[model samples]
Target: MARQIFHRSTSTFPADKVYAVMVDPDQLQARLDELGGPGAALLVYAADDGGVRYRLRHGIDPSRLPPMLQNLAPTELRIERTEALRPVGPGRYAGTVGVEIVGTPASITGTLRLTDTAEGSEFVIDGTVTVKVPLIGGKMEGILVEHVQDLLASETAFTQEWLARTYT
Candidate 1:
Protein backbone atom coordinates (compact mmCIF):
# COMPACT_ATOMS: atom_id res chain seq x y z
CA MET A 1 0.00 0.00 0.00
CA ALA A 2 1.03 3.56 -0.58
CA ARG A 3 0.74 6.20 2.13
CA GLN A 4 0.13 9.83 1.30
CA ILE A 5 2.12 12.65 2.86
CA PHE A 6 1.33 16.32 2.72
CA HIS A 7 2.97 19.32 4.36
CA ARG A 8 2.56 23.06 4.03
CA SER A 9 4.84 25.70 5.48
CA THR A 10 4.52 29.44 5.31
CA SER A 11 7.64 31.55 5.29
CA THR A 12 7.99 35.20 6.10
CA PHE A 13 10.25 35.63 3.07
CA PRO A 14 8.98 36.25 -0.42
CA ALA A 15 8.80 33.38 -2.85
CA ASP A 16 11.66 34.73 -4.93
CA LYS A 17 13.92 35.01 -1.92
CA VAL A 18 12.90 31.61 -0.68
CA TYR A 19 13.48 30.13 -4.09
CA ALA A 20 16.88 31.74 -4.30
CA VAL A 21 18.02 30.19 -1.07
CA MET A 22 16.57 26.82 -2.02
CA VAL A 23 18.63 26.65 -5.17
CA ASP A 24 21.76 28.17 -3.71
CA PRO A 25 24.36 25.50 -3.13
CA ASP A 26 25.87 27.30 -0.18
CA GLN A 27 22.55 27.63 1.57
CA LEU A 28 21.66 24.00 0.95
CA GLN A 29 25.09 22.87 2.11
CA ALA A 30 24.68 24.80 5.32
CA ARG A 31 21.26 23.30 5.81
CA LEU A 32 22.57 19.83 5.23
CA ASP A 33 25.38 20.47 7.64
CA GLU A 34 22.97 21.32 10.41
CA LEU A 35 19.76 19.40 9.81
CA GLY A 36 20.67 16.65 7.40
CA GLY A 37 21.38 13.40 9.16
CA PRO A 38 24.83 11.83 9.43
CA GLY A 39 26.58 11.25 6.11
CA ALA A 40 24.40 13.79 4.37
CA ALA A 41 25.94 15.42 1.31
CA LEU A 42 25.07 17.27 -1.87
CA LEU A 43 25.87 14.98 -4.74
CA VAL A 44 24.84 16.80 -7.90
CA TYR A 45 23.69 20.26 -8.87
CA ALA A 46 22.76 21.78 -12.20
CA ALA A 47 20.99 24.86 -13.39
CA ASP A 48 20.08 26.39 -16.70
CA ASP A 49 17.56 28.74 -18.26
CA GLY A 50 14.89 26.19 -17.55
CA GLY A 51 15.38 25.79 -13.78
CA VAL A 52 17.45 24.15 -11.04
CA ARG A 53 17.94 20.59 -9.93
CA TYR A 54 20.05 18.91 -7.27
CA ARG A 55 20.65 15.58 -5.67
CA LEU A 56 21.50 14.90 -2.03
CA ARG A 57 22.45 11.96 0.09
CA HIS A 58 21.40 11.40 3.69
CA GLY A 59 21.33 8.49 6.08
CA ILE A 60 18.84 7.02 8.50
CA ASP A 61 20.23 6.08 11.86
CA PRO A 62 19.30 2.63 12.96
CA SER A 63 19.15 3.74 16.57
CA ARG A 64 16.32 6.10 15.76
CA LEU A 65 14.24 3.41 14.15
CA PRO A 66 11.28 2.02 16.03
CA PRO A 67 11.89 -1.22 17.86
CA MET A 68 9.67 -3.09 15.45
CA LEU A 69 11.72 -1.88 12.49
CA GLN A 70 15.20 -2.09 13.90
CA ASN A 71 15.42 -5.83 13.68
CA LEU A 72 14.26 -5.84 10.11
CA ALA A 73 16.22 -2.86 8.90
CA PRO A 74 19.82 -2.55 7.96
CA THR A 75 22.32 -1.10 10.37
CA GLU A 76 22.19 2.05 8.31
CA LEU A 77 19.99 3.15 5.47
CA ARG A 78 21.24 5.59 2.88
CA ILE A 79 18.73 7.85 1.15
CA GLU A 80 19.27 9.60 -2.13
CA ARG A 81 16.99 12.52 -2.77
CA THR A 82 16.62 14.51 -5.98
CA GLU A 83 14.73 17.76 -6.37
CA ALA A 84 13.94 20.06 -9.29
CA LEU A 85 12.22 23.40 -9.53
CA ARG A 86 11.09 25.54 -12.42
CA PRO A 87 9.28 28.82 -12.66
CA VAL A 88 5.62 28.21 -13.33
CA GLY A 89 4.42 31.78 -13.31
CA PRO A 90 5.10 35.14 -11.76
CA GLY A 91 5.91 34.62 -8.10
CA ARG A 92 5.24 30.93 -8.39
CA TYR A 93 7.37 27.80 -8.86
CA ALA A 94 6.54 24.15 -9.38
CA GLY A 95 8.83 21.29 -8.46
CA THR A 96 9.17 17.59 -7.87
CA VAL A 97 11.19 15.48 -5.47
CA GLY A 98 12.08 11.84 -5.36
CA VAL A 99 13.57 9.83 -2.51
CA GLU A 100 15.12 6.41 -2.86
CA ILE A 101 16.14 4.15 -0.05
CA VAL A 102 19.24 2.41 -1.31
CA GLY A 103 19.15 -1.34 -1.06
CA THR A 104 15.51 -1.32 -0.01
CA PRO A 105 12.16 -1.63 -1.68
CA ALA A 106 10.86 1.70 -0.41
CA SER A 107 10.56 5.02 -2.17
CA ILE A 108 8.93 8.43 -1.87
CA THR A 109 7.87 10.76 -4.66
CA GLY A 110 6.27 14.15 -4.40
CA THR A 111 5.20 17.34 -6.08
CA LEU A 112 6.13 20.70 -4.62
CA ARG A 113 4.64 24.13 -5.05
CA LEU A 114 5.89 27.49 -3.92
CA THR A 115 3.92 30.67 -4.28
CA ASP A 116 3.67 34.10 -2.83
CA THR A 117 1.53 34.64 0.23
CA ALA A 118 0.44 37.81 1.97
CA GLU A 119 2.98 37.23 4.68
CA GLY A 120 5.72 35.75 2.50
CA SER A 121 5.47 32.44 0.73
CA GLU A 122 3.76 29.11 1.07
CA PHE A 123 5.63 25.90 0.33
CA VAL A 124 3.64 22.74 0.02
CA ILE A 125 4.60 19.12 -0.66
CA ASP A 126 2.25 16.34 -1.58
CA GLY A 127 3.85 12.93 -1.71
CA THR A 128 3.39 9.22 -1.45
CA VAL A 129 5.47 6.61 0.36
CA THR A 130 5.58 3.03 -0.73
CA VAL A 131 7.23 -0.08 0.65
CA LYS A 132 7.27 -3.28 -1.33
CA VAL A 133 7.50 -5.69 1.57
CA PRO A 134 4.37 -7.76 1.45
CA LEU A 135 3.34 -8.28 5.05
CA ILE A 136 4.69 -5.14 6.69
CA GLY A 137 4.55 -2.65 3.85
CA GLY A 138 1.72 -0.56 5.28
CA LYS A 139 3.28 -0.25 8.71
CA MET A 140 6.63 0.54 7.21
CA GLU A 141 5.12 3.20 4.99
CA GLY A 142 3.52 4.84 8.01
CA ILE A 143 6.81 5.04 9.83
CA LEU A 144 8.60 6.36 6.75
CA VAL A 145 5.91 8.99 6.32
CA GLU A 146 6.41 10.21 9.86
CA HIS A 147 10.14 10.45 9.36
CA VAL A 148 9.75 12.22 6.05
CA GLN A 149 7.33 14.75 7.54
CA ASP A 150 9.67 15.49 10.40
CA LEU A 151 12.58 15.92 8.01
CA LEU A 152 10.57 18.27 5.81
CA ALA A 153 9.61 20.40 8.77
CA SER A 154 13.19 20.58 9.88
CA GLU A 155 14.30 21.57 6.40
CA THR A 156 11.67 24.32 6.23
CA ALA A 157 12.72 25.73 9.58
CA PHE A 158 16.33 25.68 8.47
CA THR A 159 15.49 27.55 5.27
CA GLN A 160 13.65 30.24 7.20
CA GLU A 161 16.57 30.69 9.54
CA TRP A 162 19.06 30.76 6.70
CA LEU A 163 17.10 33.43 4.88
CA ALA A 164 16.79 35.57 7.95
CA ARG A 165 20.49 35.34 8.68
CA THR A 166 21.62 35.88 5.13
CA TYR A 167 19.12 38.46 3.92
CA THR A 168 17.79 40.23 6.96
Candidate 2:
Protein backbone atom coordinates (compact mmCIF):
# COMPACT_ATOMS: atom_id res chain seq x y z
CA MET A 1 0.00 0.00 0.00
CA ALA A 2 1.14 3.49 -0.82
CA ARG A 3 0.87 6.14 1.81
CA GLN A 4 0.13 9.78 0.96
CA ILE A 5 2.17 12.78 2.03
CA PHE A 6 1.34 16.45 1.91
CA HIS A 7 3.47 19.57 1.78
CA ARG A 8 2.75 23.22 1.15
CA SER A 9 4.35 26.64 0.87
CA THR A 10 3.01 30.12 0.31
CA SER A 11 4.47 32.88 -1.88
CA THR A 12 3.64 36.55 -1.91
CA PHE A 13 2.68 37.16 -5.52
CA PRO A 14 -0.55 37.64 -7.37
CA ALA A 15 -2.04 34.68 -9.18
CA ASP A 16 -1.75 36.18 -12.65
CA LYS A 17 1.88 37.01 -12.18
CA VAL A 18 2.69 33.63 -10.76
CA TYR A 19 0.71 31.86 -13.44
CA ALA A 20 2.39 33.86 -16.16
CA VAL A 21 5.83 33.12 -14.88
CA MET A 22 5.05 29.43 -14.52
CA VAL A 23 3.68 29.12 -18.04
CA ASP A 24 6.45 31.03 -19.73
CA PRO A 25 8.68 28.46 -21.43
CA ASP A 26 11.81 30.52 -21.52
CA GLN A 27 11.42 31.76 -18.00
CA LEU A 28 10.64 28.31 -16.63
CA GLN A 29 13.56 26.76 -18.47
CA ALA A 30 15.92 29.43 -17.29
CA ARG A 31 14.83 29.03 -13.70
CA LEU A 32 15.18 25.25 -13.85
CA ASP A 33 18.65 25.54 -15.36
CA GLU A 34 19.70 27.95 -12.69
CA LEU A 35 18.48 25.59 -10.01
CA GLY A 36 19.12 22.09 -11.49
CA GLY A 37 21.88 22.62 -14.06
CA PRO A 38 21.99 21.54 -17.71
CA GLY A 39 19.66 18.59 -17.33
CA ALA A 40 16.60 20.76 -16.77
CA ALA A 41 13.85 20.84 -19.38
CA LEU A 42 10.52 22.68 -19.38
CA LEU A 43 7.45 22.21 -21.56
CA VAL A 44 5.31 25.32 -21.65
CA TYR A 45 1.57 25.50 -21.27
CA ALA A 46 -0.34 26.08 -24.50
CA ALA A 47 -3.56 27.86 -25.43
CA ASP A 48 -4.86 28.21 -21.88
CA ASP A 49 -4.47 24.47 -21.56
CA GLY A 50 -2.87 25.03 -18.16
CA GLY A 51 -0.78 21.88 -18.36
CA VAL A 52 3.00 21.95 -18.23
CA ARG A 53 5.66 19.26 -18.18
CA TYR A 54 9.18 19.43 -16.87
CA ARG A 55 12.10 17.14 -16.15
CA LEU A 56 15.16 17.64 -14.01
CA ARG A 57 18.20 15.44 -14.05
CA HIS A 58 20.56 15.79 -11.13
CA GLY A 59 23.96 14.24 -10.65
CA ILE A 60 24.11 12.08 -7.57
CA ASP A 61 27.45 12.14 -5.83
CA PRO A 62 27.72 9.28 -3.42
CA SER A 63 30.70 11.00 -1.87
CA ARG A 64 28.27 13.49 -0.37
CA LEU A 65 26.40 10.72 1.41
CA PRO A 66 27.38 8.87 4.57
CA PRO A 67 30.10 6.25 4.37
CA MET A 68 27.58 3.45 4.44
CA LEU A 69 26.15 4.59 1.10
CA GLN A 70 29.43 5.64 -0.50
CA ASN A 71 29.56 2.51 -2.58
CA LEU A 72 26.81 3.86 -4.79
CA ALA A 73 28.50 5.60 -7.67
CA PRO A 74 27.45 8.94 -9.08
CA THR A 75 24.35 8.63 -11.24
CA GLU A 76 21.66 10.73 -12.86
CA LEU A 77 18.32 10.98 -11.16
CA ARG A 78 15.60 12.10 -13.53
CA ILE A 79 12.43 13.73 -12.21
CA GLU A 80 9.83 14.00 -14.90
CA ARG A 81 6.12 14.72 -14.88
CA THR A 82 3.07 16.43 -16.39
CA GLU A 83 0.43 18.26 -14.39
CA ALA A 84 -3.09 19.30 -15.24
CA LEU A 85 -4.28 22.63 -13.83
CA ARG A 86 -7.93 23.33 -13.11
CA PRO A 87 -9.62 26.24 -11.43
CA VAL A 88 -11.08 25.39 -8.04
CA GLY A 89 -12.25 28.88 -7.17
CA PRO A 90 -11.48 32.50 -7.83
CA GLY A 91 -7.73 32.91 -7.92
CA ARG A 92 -7.29 29.27 -6.98
CA TYR A 93 -6.55 26.10 -8.91
CA ALA A 94 -5.94 22.46 -8.11
CA GLY A 95 -4.50 19.69 -10.22
CA THR A 96 -2.80 16.32 -10.41
CA VAL A 97 0.76 15.51 -11.39
CA GLY A 98 2.58 12.26 -12.08
CA VAL A 99 6.22 11.84 -11.19
CA GLU A 100 8.63 9.19 -12.42
CA ILE A 101 12.01 8.80 -10.85
CA VAL A 102 14.30 7.43 -13.52
CA GLY A 103 15.83 3.96 -13.08
CA THR A 104 13.38 3.26 -10.26
CA PRO A 105 10.22 1.24 -10.68
CA ALA A 106 8.53 3.49 -8.16
CA SER A 107 6.20 6.22 -9.37
CA ILE A 108 4.35 8.95 -7.46
CA THR A 109 1.04 10.55 -8.26
CA GLY A 110 -0.17 13.66 -6.49
CA THR A 111 -2.39 16.69 -6.42
CA LEU A 112 -1.29 20.27 -5.92
CA ARG A 113 -3.47 23.24 -5.13
CA LEU A 114 -2.51 26.86 -5.72
CA THR A 115 -4.31 29.78 -4.18
CA ASP A 116 -3.74 33.43 -4.96
CA THR A 117 -3.75 35.46 -1.82
CA ALA A 118 -3.58 39.16 -1.13
CA GLU A 119 0.08 38.88 -0.36
CA GLY A 120 1.08 36.28 -2.99
CA SER A 121 0.28 32.62 -3.59
CA GLU A 122 0.00 29.45 -1.57
CA PHE A 123 0.77 26.02 -2.95
CA VAL A 124 -0.21 22.71 -1.38
CA ILE A 125 1.13 19.42 -2.73
CA ASP A 126 -0.17 16.00 -1.70
CA GLY A 127 0.63 12.62 -3.23
CA THR A 128 0.94 8.86 -2.96
CA VAL A 129 3.94 6.97 -4.25
CA THR A 130 3.83 3.37 -5.42
CA VAL A 131 6.97 1.31 -5.22
CA LYS A 132 7.14 -1.73 -7.44
CA VAL A 133 10.21 -3.23 -5.81
CA PRO A 134 9.63 -5.84 -3.17
CA LEU A 135 11.06 -5.97 0.36
CA ILE A 136 12.72 -2.57 0.13
CA GLY A 137 9.58 -0.71 -0.82
CA GLY A 138 8.78 0.39 2.72
CA LYS A 139 12.26 1.69 3.33
CA MET A 140 12.24 3.40 -0.03
CA GLU A 141 9.03 5.19 0.87
CA GLY A 142 10.71 6.96 3.75
CA ILE A 143 13.62 7.91 1.53
CA LEU A 144 11.27 9.21 -1.14
CA VAL A 145 9.42 11.36 1.38
CA GLU A 146 12.62 12.98 2.50
CA HIS A 147 13.71 13.51 -1.05
CA VAL A 148 10.37 15.06 -1.97
CA GLN A 149 10.49 17.45 0.94
CA ASP A 150 13.96 18.62 0.03
CA LEU A 151 13.01 19.01 -3.61
CA LEU A 152 9.91 20.98 -2.75
CA ALA A 153 11.81 23.34 -0.50
CA SER A 154 14.46 23.97 -3.11
CA GLU A 155 11.97 24.44 -5.92
CA THR A 156 9.81 26.77 -3.86
CA ALA A 157 12.74 28.94 -2.94
CA PHE A 158 13.89 29.06 -6.53
CA THR A 159 10.45 30.03 -7.74
CA GLN A 160 10.13 32.81 -5.19
CA GLU A 161 13.51 34.16 -6.14
CA TRP A 162 12.81 33.89 -9.84
CA LEU A 163 9.54 35.73 -9.54
CA ALA A 164 11.14 38.54 -7.60
CA ARG A 165 13.83 38.88 -10.23
CA THR A 166 11.51 38.71 -13.21
CA TYR A 167 8.39 40.54 -12.09
CA THR A 168 9.55 42.98 -9.50
Candidate with the greatest lDDT versus the true structure:
1
For every model shown, the clashing-pair count is: 0, 2
Candidates' lDDT values, in order?
A: 0.90, 0.67
lDDT tens string, model 2, 1-168?
576778888878876666566656776566577665436666434435554444434444445444422322245455566666666667877777788766667688998788887778888889997776667666666666776788778877877887899878
lDDT over C-alpha atoms for residue 85 of model 1: 97
- Mark the regions of model 2 whose C-alpha exceeds 4 Å error after superposition: 43-75
lDDT of 1 at 34: 86
Measured by TM-score, how close is model 2 to the native structure?
A: 0.78
Top TM-score hit? 1
Compute each candidate's TM-score over C-alphas. 0.95, 0.78
Candidate 2 lDDT score at position 60: 43
